[model samples]
Target: MKDHHPHKSLDDVHESVPIHGGKSKFKRVISFFGPAYLISVGYMDPGNWATDLAGGSQFGYALLWVLLMSNVMALLLQSLCTRLGIVRGKDLAQCNREIYPKRMNFVLYVLAELAIAACDLAEVLGMAIGLNLLFGIDILWGVLISFADTFLLLYLQRLGMRKLELFIVGLISLIGMCFLAEMFFAQPELEEVVTGFVPSLPNSAALYIAIGIIGATVMPHNLYLHSALVQTRKIDRDEHGIRKALKYNFFDSAIALNIAFFVNAAILILAASVFHKNGMHNVAELQDAYHLLGTTLGTEWAPKLFAIALILAGQSSTITGTLAGQIVMEGYLQLRISPLLRRMLTRLLAIVPAVIVIIVFGDEKVGQMLIFSQVLLSMQLAFAVIPLIHFVSDKEKMGAFVIGAKIKFFSWLIAVVIAFLNFQLVYEEVTDWLSEIDNVGLQACIVAGALGLFVLLIMTIVYPWILKRKPSRSDIHISFDDLEFKQASSFRTILLALDFSKSDEKVISQVLQYNPAISRLILIHIVESASVKYTGGQSDDYETRKDLARVEQYAKFLKEKGYDVLFELGYNNRIKAIRTMCGKYSADLLIVGSHGHNGLKDIVFGETVNKLRHAVKIPVLIAQ
Candidate 1:
């Protein structure tokens, strides 16, 4: 993980290149390109390879449409992430910390880390299998070799961030070329290949693989990582700059990810063509794919190309995965640690579980475990996606940069679809596995575990909704610590509205007794635009100048007593201003001097004091 300390200032890391105008529009667009590529790598990681392979080999290109749908979702999500980073000047995790309370930040951090660890597990396991396939190395030894790549990442950090990015780009390119060569050797029928892009599930078994493909493609950690990555360049930090960055970042993500789409689609196409077509429908294992690609294609170079691509995919992904882990930890928790220590710790979190799975289940089951790991990722998707939706959709946080109605509709649609599908997949898979077990005690334990997971999944989806549920405005339930004190005031805070009537001075005099208990006060005066306007130094209207003078006199009198006052002037009528002030100030009590009105006259014209008393939940004191 590169040194991305979350609490650090914007100027702490790279000397960001300025994205000012005067360069050609194209050149400015090029400057914002690197962040999206960093994100695009996550889309094509070794985890994706597992699902694509499983989908293709068993389903025979039937899951290609899942890949395509997953990419479109990825593009929309990542583009929102890009805009979030540019507009808020904070990453998703940082925004989470800012918008949410500390408890939620903790929960989000844990889920995000789990997603990263799950992703890392895939990358680490993929590299091991790749090593076992390309060379004669054992899987356990390859898992050990995976840790040494962290040191390589550290070394690359010294060369500069751009160089590290270029290296990953090179790896991406290499992996693409290797697969393109495989496509050449296998020579899939184009007509049949294109049919995969039309949606179909020929087998129910393909459903798990479809879920894995979606989960692996649109990752949780990448959302947090990309929001931070786009801030790498020192953007103009204005309306025009944000517009330009959003435009170009979307382009960068689309272009880079379409390349990823090709790499992913190619893998499936190769699997469908090479293995599924040749009576090898169950070749879901990466090792099996490697072994069969050579014999099936009748070319010695084919399997070698496959193994090399797998190794590159694994190594490249782990680099970014580690970086994302670092970002998640630091951004959510405000944590800072040595990059070396943090990387090893994160890798261990992945390696220990993976090593346990391989040891307990053996090598043959690791392939199934890989696909399961991705499904685990899918389960946690709701937690990450919900908060991201809340953040980008809010007009308050995003300002003019908030997503439009159409984008909001589609983004939410994607979120809801992913969440619903993930929960459904988990439910079906857990119940199916439970039914297979015959031991009563173990079955009870498994059932208990599934119930626990079900509850957790429910909470992950429910928590954001819980946060969004607005606190209802209940009537003030005022009480004192002692019953004897009930006759005394319960008001520690007060809102006093001045109407500048004959009783205004009397109301001011009455507030002295409450001053002993009152710690804060808010004074509001409304100058209705229909009644008065700010008439330069003097007004043609006599009432306007008199009203301004009265407010100033009251303000000066209040200041002389060293009272803490928040004075506000509204351009509306007194009734509306006082009514709104109750909510704005969260007033414990409202005080205003009423114009003594008799029966029919009070009913015909509105009484501001009477109106406020009826409208607000707080007690209103009217001094005549």
Candidate 2:
């Protein structure tokens, strides 16, 4: 239950992905590839299919412009997320936790969770629908099957992050290929498809679907997910490395999201070419699209491929959504849970609503359900987006990495456009609901809820500018004359842990020179080999034997120098063993040699110096 890296985002995978130095430019670019692909799936999830299908079938290629605009917004926002993670080393949620009060963060966390749940709802419905269309499974059974699929996440995550990334990338590729083949069969006119980018809403209904498309494309959860995901790569914490990471990650996001854009556009275009062209404009349901594709294209494989792609999209997206859920929960509340438990909790939240809808309204309502879920996602988008813009734009925290005015202007513009669209959607939806309802009590409750959300939204937008954020230490400058300094004290007893490396001699020499009046020198080494790890000092492993011998020689050399020396070989658990030795010897100071390992090497060899310093009360000096 110990918080080893309390400030870490996605602690299990933070800097887990190795980035090799001195590699080819292509190789370097490749290392930063996976995080963005994970993000791209969220953009092309089942929610996207519903919105895109609805837009295309109802209005032909008119809303293709929406998709294009949304992609541009997504690319820019995700790039900002990459910058925030690389420059600040915190996810959006963690940044919010630091900047906002507990109550405010709780509200934001709730909103974020709602967005994740809405996204998961689309995944559940899409998976169930895919199962029903492909196999003869009932919707209820398919829902159950989808819930059971949460276990698959456990297996996938057990395989490590890189493998999980590969799996997601494979699923994304399958989805893209399926849509590509669908395009070839539908064969829409190039002239009309290009014109879809010209931006025109055919009717007010088109506005609703357009907003849904925007919500589906520029996801709220993805903003949180991308920032945390970028931290997976073990890039050096230096300006050059950060610049390279920023550049490579921008390329990564561009390529991955453009691929996502293609998949989404392909869906809309296919719906336009196959459904609208054939005068079946009411093809809103994914089920309808599936059946219509086979008949309209005169090939059974078309619909089969459609179902397969839907299943892949749902499956892949749910996996990443669960991951985002983990990031959000840990970052906001500092609450850590097992991956399986987190997946189950999120899946269950999605399932309860899905089950109720499936039972109460039946399968026919699911397509509407998917679109509604996406609209909800759009409503929640501003909460995540606005805070992200605020965090990355702050000069005090971001140092030299603060976003420039041009980027800031566009980022705010995106936020405002999204907020305005969401506000409009809310107004229209509320007005329609109030008109239809006869009960004043129900209307009052609805109005109150809307007012509350509006206030929260305004607060989200205004709070960052109004509230004074605590500045980082780097931003605080003081004159030397204004500070008080404590007098230096010499140590009587020092405990030094040795690894028998070449630096040990240098470390010992420095320790001797540090305090000539020191009364005792306790030289210790922990036998960290597998045999001694669990067996403590009982195992007679070759590595342990050599380590003990080396400690004795050092102790003998120190004793020859007319210094009282005590040497002991600890078993395992370097920090614990060193702490125990420090207490036993009553050491006033501890000296340890630094291997200068960082990033992946720290993960491999263990961050002994850093961990040991915190584990013991005595001062720890790293002999470089």
Candidate 3:
């Protein structure tokens, strides 16, 4: 038999820290709320406040029905987002890129970027408006001040997510207090407030505002944000904990939006009671109605309270919006754009237009832009929503956690209606623009623009459906058993391959627990795959010899620990050489680490461990 001392230095191979037994049930359950609560605040932005105020004021309590309905819908979708992260161990954007084709993935990326940009614009405007209301400063200067918020966000990241969570919770509480205070002071008649809660439509304009409330509250970017954030927690596979987490998510969402609902209702109630009855109708700007609070309520408390809440709402939502943009860009593009760069990109997009409008037309024009931006965001929601619903429902991707029948039906119904509503809104806006242009050439240009947008919209809706076709079995022919490995028995020799990646330590640690049963341990390093370009004329054989020396050093360390060991080096055709080593040594098992690449690379390359297992007879183990 070959001398076992050949593998003596194997001890130097990367080893993982042992996992202590699973976490307690209580700890796992409580950990779930951390992410859900942080991500939900994206819905409670100043833009949302404006919409709710607009909804309640113009139509009174009739639009409250939309808030109730949209929250229920958001709860269902957000729950799906959490489930996808927990079960797959990946965020929604990463999953979509893995399952979809390159061209389609590009389209999804552009649409998401546009939506986030639109949202960031809203935050910038809201912040500027809040500053204007609070300090009597120029809105342009307020927009410039908003740039410092990006650094503040980066600073918050250093304190860790927990600190950020507590901050948002406190801010949200302040918003609740401000609104509650305003509601008490305004003291609208109980009978009129009760009438507002009943479901009814005021007019076409009110209906559009109601749709905006739904769109702003249950945003598409937030679905991506929540899914990615949930992955930060280390949760066990305990089914009960997952269920508890889901329940907490629903409760967190309900409470956050309930605060939102009352604030929205209060805005409208204050507006309707103060402005509508006095014949000071059509309060386009928030400041327009601010003076009435002091005059009608016989106190200055209401205006100051409203301005403070608006500032809190703007700042709080901006933090989340910035974080969501980071998660989306990183997850989908796989590019690590620095936080400063991302912040600048979003801020510039928002501030330039905001500054131009304020400088050209003044602060009064900001509200109209706010309305346009919210509607633009509403139109973009389907882009994120459709991909999420489609990918989560696929069994091959999501496995046992695939969306249930009832959830699927309802999600698709909402997706269809949202797409239609966005389409109609886009159409009306374009035609209305064309109607304003009297010149024939400008009208012709508008017609072509509308046609192009319609085509783009149709393509976005149908693209996922087209990609859902199942691949033929022959296209991805490997069987599950081909990748499966059995635990080692005493008589066998095991070969372990190490790549020094993050996953490498995990595999090494798992293998060390085996009983000293294996007659031999081979620690092999193949230098053929290493890049030669940076090695400065070093021959392939030279590099292989050097790696072999390292392998021998590793084997020596293992031998001192009383385990039989050997080392080998190979320079060419890695898969072929690994197979040859297994056959020559009659190795009983092979272990490798994988990055868990899915889809095309998985199909074409057949995974290194899977390829070796098929080429030879030994069992193969893959550590992710």
Q: Assess each prediction's global lDDT (C-alpha) against the native.
A: 0.77, 0.86, 0.69
Instruction: Judging by TM-score against the true structure, name the best candidate.
Output: 2
Task: Put down candidate 3 lDDT per residue, 54-135, tens digits, no spaces.
Answer: 6655766567677777767777788788777655655667666655666666766776777777777777877777788778
Candidate 1, 176: how far from true, in Å? 0.6
User: Which of the two, 2 or 3, has more TM-score?
Assistant: 2
RMSD of each: 20.8, 9.9, 13.2
Model 2: per-residue Cα lDDT over 1-624, one tens digit each: 111123677777889998866648777778889999999999988888877888889999999999999999999999999999888888888888777777878988998999999999999989899999999799888988999889988898788889999999999999989988898888899999999999798888998888777767888899999999999898877778889899999999999999999999999999999998889888878898998999999999899999999999999999988889998998888788988889999999999988998899988888777867876786788888888999888787788789999999999999988888876766776788899999999999989988888888888778888977643211112535678999967788988889888879778977778544556898888787887756665578798788888888998888887788888888778888899999998899898998777989998978888888789998888898
The parts of candidate 2 lying over 4 Å away from their true place are 1-6, 435-437, 470-624
**Where is model 1 more than 4 Å wrong at Cα?**
1-15, 20-22, 432-624
> TM-scores across all candidates?
0.70, 0.75, 0.69
**Which of candidates 1 and 3 reaches a greater TM-score?**
1
**lDDT-based ranking, best first?**
2, 1, 3
lDDT tens digits, residue span 1-624, model 1: 111233432223433556646658777777676767777877887778867887888888899999999999999988888887777777777766655656656866887888888888888898999899889888988888898887888788667667777898899889989988998998899999889888888767777778778878888888888887777777666688678778888889999889899999999999899888887878767888888887888998999998888889888888877778777776777666778897898899888887887788788777766867686687677777777877787786688888889998998899988887787777776777778887889879877866765676566556545756433111122234323633665577778888767887777876655664354677777665443444422233555656767777776787677666676665555666678877888989888887778678887966777667788898888877
Worst 10 residues of 2 by lDDT: 470-479
**Model 3 misplacement above 4 A:** 1-29, 238-241, 438-461, 464-624
